[model samples]
Target: MPRRCTRNRRLVLVVLFVAALFVPALANAEPAVWVVKGPHATVYLFGTIHALQKDDPWRSPKIDAAIQQSQTLWLEIPNVDDSASMQPLIMQLGMDQAHPLSTKLTPDQLAKLTRAANSVGLPGGEAMFESFKPWLAALTLSIAPLMQAGYDPSTGVEMELKPEFVKANKPVKGFETAEQQMRYFADMPEKTQIDFLSSELDDFDSAIEKFKQMLAAWSAGDVDALDKLNNADFRDKYPELFQILVVKRNQKFTTQIEDLLKGDSVSFVAIGAGHLVGKDGVPAMLEKQGYKVTRE
Candidate 1:
């Protein structure tokens, strides 16, 4: 196994924790935002790209107004920016030295993985990946290309929005903890994790192009296209991942929004754009519960 030096380990943390989860978008973006109106509560459901290039204008007047009106902010997880708190947890959950990837992947697959890693600038090459669990490897590989293409995770939507709320002393909450979110991948069966990694590696060559398409669709606020581009293939290819990562989480998010409607405060909820489109998305589920969900 390759040595887990400080630089490479920090790279893993950045890729897995920050850059890889959400898609990215471009400037002058309309992107999607839904206003769920209840008798006493108003919750803004805004779709967010986790990483963005410098000067990507993802905000609009409507979005700015909503932020001002809201008293609380909701994100997938609030602790994402707290790397010191999250690093040890990531190490515990994402590493599996006892089960080297060499034993799980065939020699041919290993060779391809090495190539894919190098192509994207992942550190340590084939030997270093030995301790990485399949899910971690897949995430690291998927985002490396985008990072190389100039996406900056530090400027992501969550990163940008969090500070304003903190300075204002407004409460920011999460649908789940960071540990719970990571467990969605870490708890998968070994075979399932390998399959997930293999699928990502198989598509390594076109990941950037796919991301660009997503960027265009999301920037244009094309929910239908987003559904097709982001959800369809993954749902068909890895139903378990689709169920666990998307469907169930959307359900949980919708439920949380519904609970918020039972109260009397305004809240801004920003999550990955993929979770807000499609029929199984949070917006659709909220509509089914008799809330007036208006796309703004």
Candidate 2:
């Protein structure tokens, strides 16, 4: 072949080869949970599913009561709706067209997202998604259906924990700021993001399938099932990412919890359910340190 033709052939082969290597990692990840314990305080390690179908049972009067009795609220990030509270930070974190997420994919791959969004019956059709960031798009893909069903983020143990605490003027704090949480999206290399978004794009059917099994486990209070689903392997390999995302953040809240006990104030820390379960879970870490956690 001519030199120019040979170079073009090699380029096409390289692109195809790279793509083949990426697609399978997309299919295997699962999310789940486990529980842990500590002294002087109770940390309920609940594994949370960002999305769930309408009919799973995970009512915890214990958790409700725990929130009511606790002195503060701790979370993975400051609440998303608390935009005014974190506006400057959020602005600094925004992504733009020069960094345009879609540019990372072929036109065909992008079109698949359109079909995926439509398949799940998302609102305003195409207009609903305009000007949205890829991370927000991923967030929307993960949670909307569960919202559409009966799972209310607003009604979850965390949301309910807020109003009552605020009524008492209790302090609500986040381990990380809004910019930090949102960066989990912005920091992804373009291809990894495409992988993230693509998994979410046409994700409803698979999400629905997983929801069924997830619900069964949640209803049964099968913490191990939740842990298995959360995929401990992914957590193991990505220790640094996991630390930034969950563990190190959990450590910040632990200090606050320790301080609370000193004041005779029983504080309720509501974090992502996943944070409380497993060997790496807060409760386990605390138990190792001698805090007694009683699961209800």
Candidate 3:
């Protein structure tokens, strides 16, 4: 199965709470960073990978410097780690016991899902995931492999960075609230959600491998490679999802960054690496708006 399905989820969902946490900076790592300057404000844009193994190093001195220079940090959400607040929302929007997975998926898909569940050490049994809405099920399946592969969300960039911001008395803002982020998936048409689940099922076995490829590209600061490897196939296979999850969100974020630039404060904006690359990425959008955007 192609890794496109998994790639799509990793790019966006990882930024939400789907993927796990952070590690020290690797001397050789240079994930892409962009400097966007407005007349009065300067914003540093850095792409982030949400889940990473303990051995992985992504923070570079440039990023460190940017963090020091900025008065505020901006992420996809301000409270990504607040599971207590998220659980109720998930229960309300992500469960559908009355409908059940058996009713929505084909026999073949159910079988694949079963195998995927077992591989990830999830409870065995056909009904194990029956109560999950298709989108939630897909996210569950996608996240398990990453965790099994030793990816920790507790160590992800935001997890590591949020604390420093708090200690410094720097405000950490978000492009959206966690509820809005969740609704992006929960509000999808059932057919689209099912298709997302099916694709995830097809790509289950390659989840870790695909993520490694993406991580490599990110670490190398190869935006072109990252774009082709992560965004292209996903955009082609699921255009609507790509638009909703990536493009539209980037557009909004770009606008927000632009507005931030009009102020005198320096801000560092970190988001999913996938949103920092490609034509519709936040950096590109800002460049088109006549801001001085320089790759660092």
Q: What lDDT tens digits, residue by residue, belong to model 1 across residues 1-296?
A: 35545545554446434422356666677888899988899999998778888877888888999999999999988865776676676689888879898889988779889998777666667776898888878777767787789886767888888898999999989888878877888899988888888988888899888988888888888999989998899899999878988899899999999999989999999888888989999999998988889988
Per-residue lDDT for 1-296 in model 3, tens only? 45644433333443366521122234589878899887889999988767766756777799899999999999988986664566667678887978888789998999998888887776544566888889888887877787777776667788788999999999999988987887888899999988888888987887777777776677788789888877797789999988877888889998899899999999999887778888978888988998878987
**Model 2 ranges off by over 4 Å:** 1-61, 77-92, 123-132, 202-204, 232-244, 251-263, 288-290
RMSD of 2: 12.4
Against the unseen true structure, what C-alpha lDDT does each candidate score?
0.82, 0.50, 0.78
- After superposition, candidate 1 runs with Cα above 4 Å error: 1-21
The Cα error of candidate 3 at residue 74, in Å, is: 0.6
TM-score of each: 0.94, 0.67, 0.91
Candidate 2 vs candidate 3: the TM-score winner is 3
- Estimate the TM-score for candidate 1: 0.94
- Cα lDDT, model 1, residue 252: 94
Ranking by lDDT: 1, 3, 2
TM-score ranking from best candidate downward: 1, 3, 2
List, residue by residue over 8-27, the lDDT tens digit for candidate 2.
Answer: 33222221111100101012
Show pairs that collide, candidate 1: 2-127
Off by over 4 Å in 3: 1-15, 19-27
Better of 1 and 2 by TM-score: 1
